[model samples]
Target: MKKVNFRNKDMAWDISALILYPPGFNEASQYPTIVSVHPFGSCKEQTSSATYGKALAEAGFVVIAYDASFQGESGGEPRYIEDPSQRVEDISRVIDYAVTLPYVDADRIAGIGICGGGGYIFSAALTEKRLKAVVGITPVNLGRLFREGFSQYNPVAALEAMAAQRTIEARGGEMQVNELLPATPQVATENGLTERDVFEATDYYKTPRGQQPGGATRMLFSHAQKTLSWDAFAYAETLMTQPVMAVVGQKIGAFGGYRDGHEIYGRSIASKDRQLVELEEWSHYDLYDKAQPVSAAMEQIVPFFNKHLS
Candidate 1:
């Protein structure tokens, strides 16, 4: 593993990343590459690295896992804001950087994203023709989640409140933020977050299972404006012509990745090679770092990319 950095398109900030090369990698020859994306509120050091990034590299691909702007080791101000548009663009930027490498096979580059990164990777592949093959490991469509409340959320009402807060902040008021996960599982139980997804979220994100600095479960409240309106899979059926795969755990609810995985596979009508895989016993977060689930996921991912990325 090697740490690297590159300026985004605008050169406004540097995106921090960890690049892993397959064994016997050579600079003299090109290799198929993957831009492995971390989940929402996650960084390169987390699952993107611990699991998929490493796993894919071991499977004979050059994988780069990066931190989104304003999150993790990446540069930007008002940190931890989950900007949907920015996240989508970050993948493109990573690809832009990838193409510059002498050892990267420009036409064979692909992307695989976990959790929200899964959704963002799909969004990226919609327009990024350079991404020959794509994978979404339990994706969460951010805009859809915000617009259609995961848990009795009122989109209009929430939008109204977020608009009000943005106005206040623009007028010199204090910045407000939203917490993605409760501080602890016990706290979650006290607050009545009893759903399977919520419990697993608290366990995976709040505890050592997947926690990392800068990948904290928080974001600027005002980011809701764009998040609520953005649609990760909009026009996917018409525009997403790339080979696509949606790997989801059957034990998903509230988290919504299962629904999203099924939706993308069904809706991307133009993707003649699209696939949907449902692992029966694994929950949403189980695929993030668990041995059994991650290993199971790799079985499908390695062969798919191997066949498609040629």
Candidate 2:
């Protein structure tokens, strides 16, 4: 694995990334490349990102796991801002860097994103023709996640409150920041979230199990406006023509499920080659780290990239 830094021309931020090579990799020969995108408010070092990078690399592809601009080790001001548009642009920016490497096969570039990053990968693949193939693992379209609640429960009032906050921020009010997970297990238990998705997320992200110095738990509250309005599959009917695969867990909790993956596959009208794989008894967070579920997801992912990228 090698660390790399490059300029994100679109956002004017320096992106940090790690490139993992296949075992006994030979720089003299060109190899298919895959970009692994991290989850929301997460960094390149997170379990999903590292897992994809290592697994794909061992499968004989040059894999890159990158920190999105403005988060993790990347260079940007007002840190932890979650701009969907910029996140999509970050994938293309990383591709731009990948093409410059002599050992990389520019024509065979592909991408895989986890959680919210999965949504960004789909959004980027829509217009970024350079990405030959794309895979989404337990994807979440933040727009839908914010506008329609996780279980499609009532969330209109919450969205309206976000709009109101947007107005406040526009008036120079201090930017409100919010935590995506409880800072402590006790807090999660106190909030009656003992076995919920957020509870698991809190344990994974805030504890030693998946913690990383660069993996922040907070994000700018104003980002809710952009997330509520953005649709990850806005152009799937026509613009998203690339071969795609979406892998989702069958037993994902109340906060998320196979809805986004199903929606993405169903709406990919222009894609002649698209598939959805649901791992049995796997929760959304399980796909992030658990060995069995992650491996199950990779079984679909590796072949999808190999078939398309070849």
Candidate 3:
């Protein structure tokens, strides 16, 4: 794998990415390519690269795993903003860069997004016609995640708070940041989140299991409004027309991934083809990096891309 950079011209920022080539790569030969997107508040190196980047490259496809705008090694102001609209646009920008390469077979392109990345890829497929196939891995719909929460909440309250924070920031006050999950396992227990998936998330994002410099588990408080209101699976039956597959784990507790994955698959009746693969033993975070769960996911994932992008 080698480093590459491209512009998100719409957002006026740059995306930092790792492009992995199949063995004995040659510029003269065109190959099917995939854009691997990382989860919310995560970087390319954590799951996208650490798990799937090299695997897909070895499977004989050119793969580009990228850091989202305003996070990881990518460039943007007021960093750590996990905006769904921008994130969805980022995939297309990467596709723009991918097609320009001499070795890429633009017509055979597909995408797989992890967690929030999964939602973004789904949203991208709703309109991005160039994508022949798309997959959602442990998909989290930010709108559903925020609005519904563990039980439910008055989203107006959260939106009001976000507006207040933006006002403060406009006055040159300190920017507020919020953690995506309990900071640690102990913290999770103290907060009464003793689920297997929640604990696994704390382990992966907060500890050495998945921690990295740019993969911060924080997002801007001011930007929460957009995420709270945007539904990742909105208009699935009408808008999404690409071949789709949702690689989901058994939902353990109130986790958003399982719910969103099934939601998208069930709703996308208009897709060219739609499939959902559920690994009963795995939880949401288990699919993030665990060997057994990851392998199971790839079994469904690899062939879908292979068939559609062939």
Instruction: Report lDDT per candidate.
Output: 0.89, 0.85, 0.87
Best candidate (score: TM-score) = 1
Candidate 1: segments with Cα more than 4 A from true spot: none
Off by over 4 Å in 3: 8-11, 150-152
For residues 141-260, what per-residue lDDT tens digits would candidate 2 score against the true structure? 877877775314556666676678878988998777887777887889898877656887888898888899999977877555577678999979898899988999887665554889
Worst ten in a row by lDDT for model 2: 149-158
TM-score of every candidate relative to the true structure: 0.96, 0.92, 0.95
Q: Which candidate would rank higher by lDDT, 1 or 2?
A: 1
How well is each residue in 163-253 modelled by candidate 1, as lDDT tens digits?
8998998999999977878898999999998788888888988888777886777888875578888899999989999999999999967
* Local accuracy of candidate 3 as per-residue lDDT tens digits, 113-193: 888889999999998988999999988887777787722577888788889999999999999988778887789989888
Clashing pairs in 2: none
Cα error, residue 200 of model 1, in Å, equals: 0.8
Ordering by TM-score: 1, 3, 2
